[model samples]
Target chain A: MFQKTLTLVLVGVLFMGIATLTYGTFYDKGFAASVTGMMGLGDDEHGEDGDDD
Target chain B: MTKLRLPKAFELLLVWHGLLVGSYTIAYLTAEGAPVLHQFAGYSVLGLLAVRLTAALIAGVRPPWALPLPKASMWKNFGRKLAAGHFSALLGRTPFAPLSGLVILGTLVLVTLSGLAADWWEWEDLHEGLAESSLAVVLIHIAIVSFAPLLKRLNASRADAAATALPRNA
Candidate 1:
């Protein structure tokens, strides 16, 4: 019984890992943009520093 | 002593997956800057895991070194044995194998999830933390595998001691 439960858990984790990796790899550009934005690494055009002339 | 042998196919798959994934991770850490290659490795690992999980679910057609599934008793008695300092016996038991498998899978999931989030959502902190954790888990897994034979010997010695003591008492 416990073995069955453990198997289920293993499958669940594997599925989640696969899904996450697929998403990150296939959509690299968007992910990179969002991550950089979140880190406040956006360029001048996207930056919110409010020093526009 | 029953020789410890994992299914040949399963073992090969695991070794291949480990090499691919490990290299990619090392590249990432060392600032190799080849994002495409890293992504490709991630996809390959995802494919390999899918195949492995599918084979596990199927009946009567598992690979030669079938997946090591621990018995129910191991989880039940884990705490008691752990508290009693029976480390060698615990490690040597067939039932205890699943816990290590669980740790490996759980940490892999964390690493993948955090890596994705860091890349797409800028959660660099989460990614870095999980990356370190994944490395630690992998190292421990390797250490346990390497020490299995020594642990089995220790377990045998303990049993011998018990048998000798019983004769003296009689």
Candidate 2:
């Protein structure tokens, strides 16, 4: 059970990382901004391209 | 040599549960500063919820796809066992599991719908509120699942100790 839980956690982290990268690339945001934004700690501007809103 | 295979419904349930967990985690984590990722994860959650609800409708109240509404009889039985001093009952599946699941599902549906409406209307506050409150439901669910196994191990160790003590007493 521990192993399975660890595996799932790792997979979830990988998924989140890939999602952050993809969002960063598609929106032209840097990787650091993407990570910080996803973590809700970034001060970056949003909805500039009229897409997020 | 025969290979073991899980039932199709069970396998699908596992997959759906994993995806829902992943999507909800992403959506919740991204809700503050990451609009694009938040919307993406939130929509994934909405889509997954739709599929789950549809499957429940088609499959009826069966295992793996059943609605998480705990029946009154189940609650009554669980209460009776607890009253009878069956601490071991805590080690097994309890009605709270389904109840928590139902709560989580309801909260997620409301959150997603409010979020969808927020896209065009002034419902962002409502969406955020629902999303924030849903975290409690998720945490409760996690607690229930995590503690059950721990309780089972504790019960097993106690039983082993009791058995050993009985021999010494004899």
Best by lDDT: 2
Per-residue lDDT over B1-170 for candidate 2, one digit per residue giving the tens place of the 0 to 100 score: 99998667765666677777888888888787777778888888899899999989988978879898889998898899999998777877889988998999999999999999999998988998999899999999889877887877887999999999998899
Regions of candidate 1 where Cα sits further than 4 Å from its true position: A1-53, B1-34, B59-69, B75-96, B150-170
Off by over 4 Å in 2: A1-13, A27-30, A44-53, B1-7, B157-170
Q: Write the per-residue lDDT of candidate 1 for residues B1-170, one digit (tens) a residue.
A: 88987655644555544443444343243222334434454555445555555666663345533445654677657666777886645455544454566576566666666656656897767866776677787677656654666666777999999999998899
Q: Indicate the docking level reached by candidate 2.
A: acceptable
Give lDDT: candidate 1, residue B50.
52
Q: Residue B12: error of model 2 in Å?
A: 1.7
Q: Once model 1 is optimally superposed onto the true structure by TM-score, how far is the C-alpha of residue B61 displaced, in angstroms?
A: 11
